[model samples]
Target: MDHDWMYKASYTSEIYAAGVQSFLSAAEANRVKKRSRSICCPCSVCQTFQYFEDITEIEAHLFENGFMPRYDCWSRHGESLAAFSTSSTANDTTYNDDASSLNSTYNNDSSNLDENDNHLNGPDDNLNEMLHDMETNMGDAEIENLQHLFEDAEKPLYTGSRLNKLDAVLNLSNLKSKNKWSDKSFTKLLVFLHDRMLLEDNELPISTYRAKKLMCPMGLEVERIHACPNNCILYRKRYENEHKCVVCGASRYKQKKDSDEVDDDEGPKQPGNNIDVYLSPLIDDLKTLWDLGVNLYDAYGKEHFQLHATIFCTINDFPAYDNLSGYTTKGKKACPVCENETSATRDVFSTIIFDIMVHLISHIVQEIKACGPVFLRYMYPFERYMSVLEGYVRNRHRPEGGIIEGYTSEEVIEFWQGYVKGLDSVGIPKTRHSGRLDGHARVGFKTFSPSHEDLHDAHFVVLKHMTCLAPYANEHMQMLRLTHPGKDDM
Candidate 1:
């Protein structure tokens, strides 16, 4: 797990992150019916710190619309921009430095900065730094606040116990995070995580987050569940250091909760704050589903690990969507498969890898008329596939509602290439993109004019993966059969 990218976000004003931490702390407080405190955020990345903190009342607008596909879509999504950058493959050759860069925050602690922030009550140095940094670059917090104002915790019309992986990834027609994530940021992060997991192996270290436990259970006996100031170690460390790590002699001492660093005989690090291991519990749960082929918006299904693998394999990768207006679109309601409102979104999260698997499985089962080859020969060891899938999943994937609308043709095209090649290990068609005769699409050209070709490329990656999937499926089965002979039927 090249966790170097773990704390990548600028470590700035992610209100969503703050909110989650607060909510986690609050949950640990006495007198709560549910150990979990649910706060509403659009998705993981786009939420605000306040949102994570349980700053509002709970209410939900039940939506009823959209067709419910049992699982995620094997091939769907309006690829205005997503299709253009289909060059990135899960394969190594097409990896880029920028995608990784996007998730990581840079801490040039070579300079003397703050020390310990022991007193959460005192002015928190870490929080200050993040706030300062964000104010400098993003200007004001108008956008963040406004988005929050309109946000709602309305129960998703799509309710379900669980879903097939493919059926509802982006379904509002379906089922239902945080760095202090915002709705907008949540959408952005989802897209980021999806691409990273699907494309960048460096992002995921755990080949697969094996379903060893139903929950990421932590013992309060070993570690304090909530310690204010301690709860917000970042702030406390900054204050304690009098805003600097005393030992380092460099203002930036390695401490909990601080992003800035002081110069030292040693090189720079993120102050090694206690927050390193600390994560929003709910957010982590959200991530769990994401790894299992769910998206941020598919928050309706809260079931942990124990799910039907057979159903999971079929519904993982539904379709990608694009409604720039970013509102609920009316379609169908009261799905037959799950008795939930068929939302534009579903309860199940999804990923490109699972989608690919479903596509290939469907073909081998129905089209090729033989699931044996895929199960035996092409499927990489389930562990390796999952290892790679995790990395792909970790990369900043599609945030809640999905990617924002303001990309240029070139950017979209570039992203499309990166996504497909980096994610599926299959290259998109060059001809569809209007090559400059060398069979390569030229940079900065207007080659992207939405064609049916885009759709085929999106769906074809799954088809192509089928070519290799046969072997992996066989191996996956072989391994599973040995371990859980009774359950290998999936």
Candidate 2:
């Protein structure tokens, strides 16, 4: 292949265009031969760190940003090592300053190049950075285990297979989650694959337990903190060794395990006014984040920095807001912002009746000044998320478990979708709202044409309500009234 076009001054040149077309054609052929939809994009922006499924996108990126420096080998795009070596030896004069600088950075060590290349070929740049960070903090045994994981990630699922063991396991895990397969069934499927389909030396895990174990290191740890049964407090920090709740004096655990009877006199499950006790852990984390921050590696920048984060604001309903902010949402002096200036009054029954919602309106201006806008700190988004969680509850009896299972399945499915190209989503497709905005059906099964009268009515309603067109409509109406003094105002 002619390589001079890659060094052209203008991407719009005919030679550059032809070269890009040829490169894409070869990449597409290689992709088909490997039974994969995506290829590693070697554009300067991607730097061979990202995979692109669409050839057009790849082409555009290459044209816009040009190829990454010193990427003449094209090993990542299925060019043979022998061919690359032969080309490099024959075209010694083609090697430029960029290649020299890259070589000098690695001290001209072949091992260094191999190590760096291997690191680059890892699952993702961010994932590689995380692994690199982990390697620094981990013990020898943990490092060995991580290395084994890397090997598994790099190893092909089977001989001549395009997919790696890690990808295969992830795909299977996602399938299991989406279909809600039992552990036994998942294990059976794994076994069937191992016994009947895969070769004897295949690296696939034979059980759900093994699969989970394989992927466990990559997952975030979930802390299980014991809380007061009455929702008074969590038994952590100062109360770690305490046997009972500090406020309610309720026992941490039930004395009898065999009894499944419910107490009719038990309080509501919500922490209510004692929500602050449950928020201790979160508060402590925030304090730490504010004061110390955390060390993190920026994969894109290829640098390390400390990341500090703090909660901008809280969003909740009026009653829950009271619990979080330690303000009384009902009765006299209910307004946290107004303080003593509240307008509460006693009713005929000697009851302090005050519209807490109306009182909250006084605080909105101040809140907006501090947090930009009410929408930014409003409960609508949280309410929508709660609705989503509610939908995830399949079993009313075990709603929490159902939500967790559903959420985990969704996460798996989402992660799997990132890897597989052209795979249809598992759930209901999102409605496109084809004709809602444009006033014409661009895409859909059915189409209708509005009658002249209906169109006129719709247009009139739109023109009358639109704030931007209100002035123009009013001006036109004024002109009409002036022109025809006999006409009555509509």
TM-score of each predicted structure versus truth: 0.15, 0.56
- Weakest 10 consecutive residues of candidate 1 by summed lDDT: 211-220
Q: Which stretches in model 2 have alpha-carbon errors above 4 Å?
A: 1-142, 182-185, 257-268, 326-384, 387-465, 479-487
- Model 2, CA-based lDDT: 0.65
TM-score of decoy 1: 0.15
Which 10-residue window of candidate 2 scores lowest in summed lDDT? Answer: 111-120
Q: In model 2, what are the clashing residue pairs, if there are any?
A: none
Listed per model in order, the count of residue pairs whose N, CA or C atoms clash below 3 Å is 160, 0
Determine the C-alpha RMSD for candidate 2 after optimal superposition of all C-alphas: 12.2
lDDT tens string, model 1, 121-186?
A: 112112222222222222122323212211111111122212211111222111111022233444
Best by lDDT: 2
